[model samples]
Target chain A: MSVENLAISFGSNQVLKSVNLELHAGETLGVIGPNGAGKTVMLNIMTGILKPDGGRLVFLGRDILKEGVVERVRMGLGRTFQIPRSFRNMTAYENSLVGAVFGSGLTERAAGARARDILDMIGLSGKKLEPAGKLGLLDRKRLEIGVALATGPRALLLDEAAGGLTESEVAEILGIVRKVKESGVGVIWIEHVLQTMLHGTDRVMLLAEGRDVICGRPRDVMSSREVEEAYLGAGVGARTRRKRA
Target chain B: MGARTSGIRQIGGAPGPRGGWAARKPLVLAAAVVVLALLPLYASDYGISVGILIFLYMSLGQMWNLLAGYSGLVSLGQQAFVGIGGYTLAMVTQAYHMSIALSFFIAAGVSLAFALVISFPIFKMSGVYFTVGTWIVSEALLVFFRNWAFVKYDAGYNITVAYRISMPALYLGALAVGLGATALVYFILRSRMGLALMAIRDDESAAEARGVRLYRTKLACFLISSVYTGITGVVLYLNITYVKPGAAFGIDWTVCMVFIVVIGGLGTIEGPVIGAVIYVILRQYTYNFPGISMIMLGVAAVAIIMLAPEGIMGAVHGRFGFRLFSTERRPPPGTGPRQYPEDAADV
Candidate 1:
């Protein structure tokens, strides 16, 4: 139900230091921070892609400090990368099939059925047979989402889902996440695109220099002085600081 | 429509176009072997030799497919094991005077064991480093075998029995082994073990996170691959009635296997078959042309990589919804998007 004092250290650098955060059963938490503020690191730690040095990580009221990425996924937790990770040799459809069989626990035929349906839903049905290596940015992003969705997570963590999208494309993806939330799945999205986060999420969690600077309503948190001086300062820079703050 | 399309997902389960490939593959395989069994009875001497060579490479290529293609290890020195297998068979059968079949089995066993022992050190290296380490290992093996001289490094063979260009018995034996190897690859890919292999290929860390005990999977793949390649070496030496360190441990074999699997379809079941058939035909006809064969093969590899990186299996998958032989499925709609689920439905 919540993260309890999760901390992670990569080599000498302690990326996350005793970070405690949570989301309600039906809420979206937007994570925003400076580039190296450990936003993606925090997501990796949560998904068990990276191990924590100290502190506890709980998923659905169970300790997940030691579970691996796929185990965490099987425990109803899933995530997508900032840069989409797909099997280059497989088709868009086949890539999702991997998620279905391994991540979603579907039988062979059932997995194909589900993968086809997911591709269709993501507007990748026509491109499903195309090699994943040949896909453009938008379709690759969609494929990333489709693969993650195939795992069927109760709580999905997205890392920069709209990184390279046009504004309209961003809005389209924002709608997809919103629809996902409607299916009773909890979402925590990290994005540098502030407006998309502000307009899309029900709540917001701002990470700064490996720590949570602000957590609450998106607009309120975005407008907070600590966030402005640290996160938005990094985003909007010192020149526009006064007006934005 | 997603729901309706989901119903059609059952199409692959039926034996519609591709034959009863899934269920009766064993029987079909047996029949093919029987056909091969009768080949020497009617075939000309040259035809038998060509057929035997095809069987040998098919075995080598399938094993190479497991190591280089599915596991993404991409070793360029697998010929070292081929040398080891041939020499071991030759020595044991010659000096020790063991049975021919026993010599082949022992060689396979030794190579499999040896490969398992070294996999850990080799795999510890990063992508290209792993490949380089294997190459060095093979080269070192070649040097050692050549210098030992007790195994007749220069002159090659000391077969007590005079043999034809090719024998019916050896061809039949090679045919059986080749069929077994392809079938073995098919079974491994279709099983949970193959899943672990693919997981390692696609994303190593992700597979580890999912409790895919990497050491065991990697060891199994290496050992199985070594055994097949090793057996081929035995067959190769026996057919020629000679075994030399240089010829037995030649890099050409490994290179050819890689070329075949790469062009056929790197990760698909049928890729190696297509690749092997094409490569064998080219090799059979191109010996007198010298380096031209290598140049053409190299050009073909570059073209395949630049144009069709996924190879023919991927092309088939892209053009039609045909897996041909892959057991992997596309995660269907309503199954949710991720591969693993807390519950079965993933809903």
Candidate 2:
């Protein structure tokens, strides 16, 4: 599932206005923005977690907004929140089990088996039975991705999965994202970590004030002047600061 | 026991609390059920009636646990449904002369339909609004039942029965209902729906952000709890053969459910079972005293909430990190990728 020409708002605050983007099979698109700039909102709109005030969301050329989040998940559209979401008291294995059993239509025993496999993929196989709340930030993020992956998604939307991680942790997360891409899952990753996102993503989009400032190749978009003024925080934005000199 | 011994015993046994609650609990519950199962057969008629009341409260507690505990609905007005169920049973059995056993199903269906309609409005509210809205709605129900003409308002209604049901029969009936209620809560918590409910409890908005259908999930839980509780009300009326507006619509029903789950473990599968047992015994023993029983209960509940905020099951969890029924993952010692194999697991 993918999005095109989407628009959304929260109350009077316009979160996203006429945003255009697409994600194909096994490709990655990076959405970069500062805090509260509506990166998450755009992802939410795309995944049908939130409804748009205007515009079209076509998943497989069918209108996706007509369906609910759980149905969309069943149709292979999965999302991860910026803060990891799990059943706190449940084992990490059980948290993923919800995705497998209900979202994937697997039986109870099958869901348990599937949860263990997902735990392994995210490098959390040994801790399948640990309560999710007790996990540290890094493991929590991994479980979030594992939950999305556990549903056997064709498209995975991640909201800041690598935030608050050290350099090595960031590299490991990048490896997981790449591995996901390699497995033929369409990926849309929203992150503030420009360096890592640049390294992991094939295409980069600059998001500012709910709309994309620029969208194209990682190098081309990052070097664009409008992107620098809004995001990328590249020398174009810094050059404006130097112009004050 | 020291913390280290608990640690060693846990590892030497199961790796975690996975099979812990499963093994010994049902055996203990079976023993308790056996005792309760036999009490009414040996005791006098009034004793059997008291046994029925125990079943009533136990079933209510189990139903409440599904909504307030497992689903995190935190309702305090289950009494509303109790009145609805009782009055509906009385109306059916008195006017229509429906079979007493079938009245239970009738009352449940009516109350569940009403609950679904009620959920349409209440499900939109969150936090305090949700809690207070239910209380007010229940109070409205109390007023309506009090003034309703056919049911005799505050005075109550009388039902017609073909014969005086035997003491052993009532006891067995209540026991059956209580056990069924507990098992239903257990199996549901052990399934897919249970995970979604606990997710609502942990962080509702985050759950929504991750594709959980907040309103539908909550509404489903509300209807299920209300229907089972409605059945409990009908059972209470069956044993007593009468129900007054104040008695049927009072806060006692909610109090019993809350007391049981709060003391037992709130969200754990075994929490309500343990809580129901403790509550029944405490009520039975304390009723022997005059006024002090209420004070004792109030003090104990307050003290437990303060000293053990997690309740009985939570305390167990704090000490051993055991989850009786959950599938969330915790990271082990290092960054060794401790996730479950999303494909298969012994869990």
Candidate 3:
């Protein structure tokens, strides 16, 4: 999947400007930026949740800007929200079953089996029958990822998959990310957890003020002056440096 | 493995040996059906008329519940389809020489077509806007029908002698439609489409992201619910032997539907049945009390809402863990404890 020359604005405040990126199979691209960097907006546009004012989004060699969210999901693009928006009244298993049945076009029996498998993969099988609204934050995040996985996407966009997670929970998520990458499905993970980005991703892209600052090897990007300057400009560099120290 | 076993037990385990209330539901429903079928033989004329009214409201309440409670499309203009159904039957049976029984099907078809046409515009609005849009549509239809020259300019239409069905047949027909609608809703809530609707109800954007075709699903629901409501309207007017534009399209129909569903249970299948029974009984007791009936009805509705916001069935289900109908899935038999790999948290 590739997005080129994408531009979007809410009134006069431009949120995304000429953003260009490409995600290829079997690669984990970690997107790191300070808050309000338009990371979520980029993911939304790619997933057909929002339309860009000016751009081309091509998935498997077809322009999909006009496709609706459901159609785009059926075409092998899947996403998880930052806040983990599972169906509150439904059990975790039912939540994933929806993704399997509708998004992946599986039969009911097959979808049921798939939902169980996903819950197991995410380490939430014990809570499969629990209503999503009652689950803790860690379980909610895991179910969110599991729902996206149930869609059988060729590429996945994870928006802040590690947000608000404990250290151990983040580690568990990174392990799942690695397993997903090994399965040859591309992933674009937006995260604020620098350590996870540095350790879990094949490449890292830094964005600031709605534009790509740099894109390279994770280690190289981390050490680059442009990356540090961007972070520092947004009041994130000192905190990150202190955390690293 | 130990944790897994305990977790399953904590979550109420599998369907037990007694299998909860859901297991006994079929037997109970069958007995009720038998009793209802034999009612005309033993019941007085007043009892049969009451039964017909109960069936009509029950069907209407169920359709509205499907639209508003399950699909989260809270329309206040269901009377639009109800009006269309009544008028279509009146026109076909009286003017077009169609048989009364055949007119029921024709009225349902007409209402379905009308719902499909109106749904395109109405669905563009979301939440409360959709509710208002439906009310406007019904009001517009009421005005049009009242002014239309062919229907005799507000003199209204009546079922002529040539197409009049017997009273018992009308009551039985209403009962059949009511039972059919209840069964249809029950089966739907247990199906894949029903799960999709519940998902949409919880969160539309999330459901859409999960590949539920939002517009198409809502439209299908609107049409289906409209068809059932339209059929109920035909049975209703046929019983009264007359159909006027004002009464057929009145907001009172919508109000009663809202009251029954809200007072019974918003999303449960049995809620409408319970609510309709209670509503019809309450109305019967108070109908001769002059202005006191409407006030009594309003007081009863407020009491239900204030005391049990989830509605009567929801309260019962909450307190007793009894579900006559359920969409929840049971665990696969003999499922063992879930295991996470040893290094799962190591990154």
DockQ for each candidate?
0.24, 0.25, 0.36
Could you tell me every candidate's TM-score relative to the true structure? 0.78, 0.84, 0.90
* lDDT tens per residue, model 3, B1-347: 99989788769756664565467778988998989977888999899989998988999999999999888999999998888888877888888877777877888889888998898899899999999999999999999988999887688887674245666787788899888888899888778889888898788899999999888888888899999899888888788778899999999999999999999999888899999999999999888898789999999999988999999998997787566777886434424433322111111
DockQ class, candidate 2: acceptable
Judging by TM-score, tell me the better candidate of 1 and 3: 3
Q: Which is better, 1 or 2, measured by DockQ? A: 2
Best by lDDT: 3
Error of 3 at A179 (Å): 1.8
Q: Pick the TM-score winner.
A: 3
Could you give me the TM-score of model 2 versus the true structure? 0.84
Instruction: Estimate, for each residue in B1-347, the C-alpha lDDT of model 2 and write its tens digit.
Output: 69999888878875454465667766866788788888965788767776776676778888888888766788878898888878877888777877777888888888888898788788888778988889888988889988888777688778656236766876787888888887887677655676677777777765654456778788888998899888888777777687788888898879888999898887776677667777877777789887899888888788878887888878987897665444343332333333332232221
* Candidate 3 C-alpha lDDT tens digits along A101-195: 89888877867766787787788888888889889998999899889988888888999999998888899999888877877788999999887
Model 1 chain B scores worst on lDDT over the 10 consecutive residues at B336-345
Most DockQ-accurate candidate: 3
